[model samples]
Target chain A: MDSYGLLIDFSACIGCKACMKACKEANNLPGDPGDHLSYSDYTVVKQQGDVFYRQMCMHCLTPTCVSVCPVGAMAKSPEGAITYDGSKCFGCRYCMVACPFSIPKYEWNKAVPVVRKCILCYSRIKEGKEPACAWVCPMGATRFGKRDRLLEIAHTRIARWPDRYIDHVFGEQEVGGTSVLMISPIAFSDIGMRNTLPNEPLPNLTWTILRKIPNIVITGGIVVGGVWWVINRRMELEKENSNGKEGKVEK
Target chain B: MGRKGKLKNKLFLFLPISLMALLGLFLTFKRFYYGLGSVTNLSDAFPWGLWVGFDVVCGVALAAGGFILTAIVYLFNAERYKPVLRPAILTAFLGYILVAVGLLFDLGKPWNIWHPMVMYNPHSVMFEVAWCVILYLSVLALEFGSIVAEALKWKKVVNIFHAVAVPLVLTGVLLSTLHQSSLGSLFLIVPQKLHPLWYSSLLPLHFFLSAVAVGFATVILESYTSSKFLKRGLELDLLVDLGRFLWFALVVHLTVRWQDLFVSGALANYRPGSLEAIAFNLEMALLIGAVVLLTIRRTHRSKLGLFFAAMFALFGVIVNRLNVSIVGMLSDTQSGYFPAFSEIIITAFLAMMGFVAFFTCVHFLPIFPQEDHNAKAELKVQLSA
Candidate 1:
């Protein structure tokens, strides 16, 4: 299966938010929610000094929202698109807590605002088109393709001009390899990539603990149940014995 | 059977009902007319508030009394504590239901809450936790239902229930253990986001221990509160037995708390002026006070002192929950988030529900044993001697 990935080279990137504008247009998003969290602005471009950073869904190998969602409202396709379903969302906001990137935003102002986030424009891709953001990035900073080819592009650049790029590819191992990759002159962690996070998927951390809950329930239930049965059985027997003694006294 | 009556016929039910009715009306109006934005102090920085933290987490923790006390008396066969079983079960029943109400209000799309069950997010911890809570609530309802049936003279039904109660009690305890710890596990994912002092991979263990300690404390308060209102004498023998359990659990909890602190290797966070330090000390002080009070045979035996200790434990539990949910939110602060007056009303209303249910059950119901007969029998024996 094809795993769609984006490699952003901050060193080559100029701080033009044309990609963000194109995403807004392609998604047919209505602008400026009375609340910024709703109404479908799928992508944003953030700048720190000379560097321009593009922000959107990482299409994480293990999306926290997927793990924490009680319903299957949030899903990650085998092809690696992180997807959402408004109809199924209970609007628990647990996904918001679980997401490391903090990308999912809620429409709290509405009677019911399901969580909103980037979806890689899978529909557009299925129709033989690149994501709107990549198509509009004239500088070629954000390019979408198979991850192996993207890694080749990243390594070639580093070898060609060693000092121009850091020795790291940001998404290669971050949160179990986000589909969106980055090569930057500055440290990725400084730009909020969370370098200290584990190389494994984020879900692995919580799942280890969660998986044991059922076991605890089963074992603890037996112990408690066993005790209750023994005690109650003894109580019933004693009452029965007492009744027999009263019958003898009557005779 | 003749003495038994409906909850509405009971004395002292007036105030809690009136308070609840008014608050319910306000909350309903606010929810429909204005929406969640008009209510809670929730923001991108904090998506949880009193509804989630207090009503659900702290409320459920306090409600642990049902399983905690039952495990002691039924599972462990501490018959000395049997007098408290009925009241503790009553509190647990109300506490879990109120938690459900709080959760319904907290949901952003409450209308779709059934999505979890139907949609089946197998990977989600929430999916697991939600199922567990629902099951546990049913178990609690059944546990308490037996006592109610017994009171209502439905002995045939009660007999059937009595047969299955041990199994139900086991299920309830197991369910309680899972969800109680899962509440802490909810925060474990936000390790970087939460203040280091509050977040731990061992959050499940921490949550379980704290709840056990709180469970014992709440029973203490409920006993005193019931005795005063129902005009029954305080059970000193039971209190002493309960005091021993409280001391043991508190010591284990303290040891774990310190163990967590030591393993973190963040000793500097424990300094006098750090926000974490103050909260740490305050919670510890309250918990330590509970422990110390239990050690004193005279104070542990005193109804007034015992009640205060229980109150202190409740305070400690509340402080810890708030620290995790609000103060420990790991994200940078966002602009302007304050809970609307409507949210406050809703919180108050839940408390009112708890009081109303508690008061109603105690009066005109066999929630408290017939202490008068027992006391008279004891007096007659002493006179004969």
Candidate 2:
């Protein structure tokens, strides 16, 4: 099955925040939406001068959150949506620390708190429906389709109007490509996106070290055992030699 | 001294410990009753604070004396260092137990801390750390258990543990090697977040090497402090030998750190007056000062000199951990996290608790050498008479 994704056109956004409202409604979130992403708000639209930027989970192909979660609580779905299982969460908040985008937020005010983040409306997508934010985007700013189709649309729009678009897809190469693709007239960095992220997936950094554990264990055990055997044997030999010398002197 | 005087002396020590523990308990209640934000300065941006940095990271590293001493005495048969080995193992056992307690305060769902045991995430560094720590804690318990069993005159149990002493120590050293380094790997995922000066692909090696160095320093500090408090003769010759080992460890650590910094071009990011640079420089200075102090014959052989050098190395390792977990990430996180008063008190309480445990074990158990134990017993008998 083709993985689904969201294509966000920053130029087309009118700063209405209808998508945010739709998200809050669909997620059953209460209270007024905050200016930033929080437990109460899964998605937020921020005004940056003339353009409005929407911030949410990037849902990377190989998400750092998924890999860092010790209990397998945070996971990437086959539908290309990153989902979180609060029940399975031990609430170490490692996901919050590991996320390059700083997407995960903690409910620090709750006695039984779990990490909160955008799940990309995984259930809705499984039901053959687009995410609430994408569906309710009045200006068609947020469009949902197959990842490949979305990337094509994003690149086409960028190529069709060089003066209108930045000629680059924001998430296409960042952190090994995210499901959420963005096209903006201004650089994404100007809108507060991390532009310095490497093209490789973030999880690879940790895996490189973790993969060495088996080798370290086997080698470390052998070295320790070898040292113990050698030291004890030498000590025994010295004891035996000293006894023999004392006996010979007595004779 | 009469029984009444002995009771009074015990009260003198127990009073302060009880008060601090009570206060810590109250604050812990507040923390659990009203959520982390109620008592902590942690926000969405800065999810971790003193609990993770000092309590877990530095705590685990400081406890390295256990594995180091065990490896030296058991593996290499350095019988001279055996006098301090029991105390070192006891410290490590308590250190790990307290680390688990500290995590209870840090985890949002403290109940699910055991999730790592069942839930497998082979790809995660945390998974590796959790397993190693768990296994190592058991190894520590078994290692320390022999001492406890000896004190209780459980000859059969002690004999059983002694039979497997080499294997147990080997397992412990292996586990310590993995988790000590894996703790550094935890931050590897946050390359973009951590400052360049502190971040390196060789972080695991740095962590492991520094842990070994700090382990020696901890053992030295423990020896001096215990000797002073117990009114016993310091193990001068053994400590001088340890000083040599510490010097070598710190030299290797410094060489690797500097080489990595230069090769990675992280030195280019160094601004002399910046916070990270200052922290990095301070850590390097302490470590280098310790090495220099240990190198000098007069200082290396002197008690005060050895104590100060060990203290310097311990403080240096503490600063390095804080720099990695907190200060280095400040520029990228912009969280501006200063730990709350409760956080500070709880950490102090945990550390005080560790000291109390150590002293109590030393007073009652055979944590020290047989001669020392006999001397103390004779002194007590004379006092009672």
Give the top-scoring candidate (TM-score): 2
The list of candidate 1 runs beyond 4 A from truth reads: A32-39, A229-251, B1-24, B330-341, B371-385
Residue B240 of model 1, lDDT score? 69
Candidate 1 whole-model C-alpha lDDT, 0 to 1: 0.76
Best by lDDT: 2
TM-score of chain B of each: 0.87, 0.93
Q: DockQ score for model 1, please? A: 0.50
Clashing pairs in 1: A67-B124, B193-B330
Compose the digit string of candidate 1's lDDT tens values, residues A140-160.
999988878898899888889
TM-score against native, each model? 0.89, 0.95
DockQ of each: 0.50, 0.59
Residue-wise C-alpha lDDT for candidate 2, range B1-385, written one tens digit per residue = 6999989998998899899999999989988988999888998888888899999999899899999999988788887776577778998999998998898898999898888999999998888877887899999989878777777767678667766878888889999999899989999999999999989999999999999999999889878866876655347988998999999999999999999998999989999899988999999889999999999999999999999999999999999999998899888889899899999999999889888888888888877655655654443223211
Position B236, candidate 1: lDDT: 81
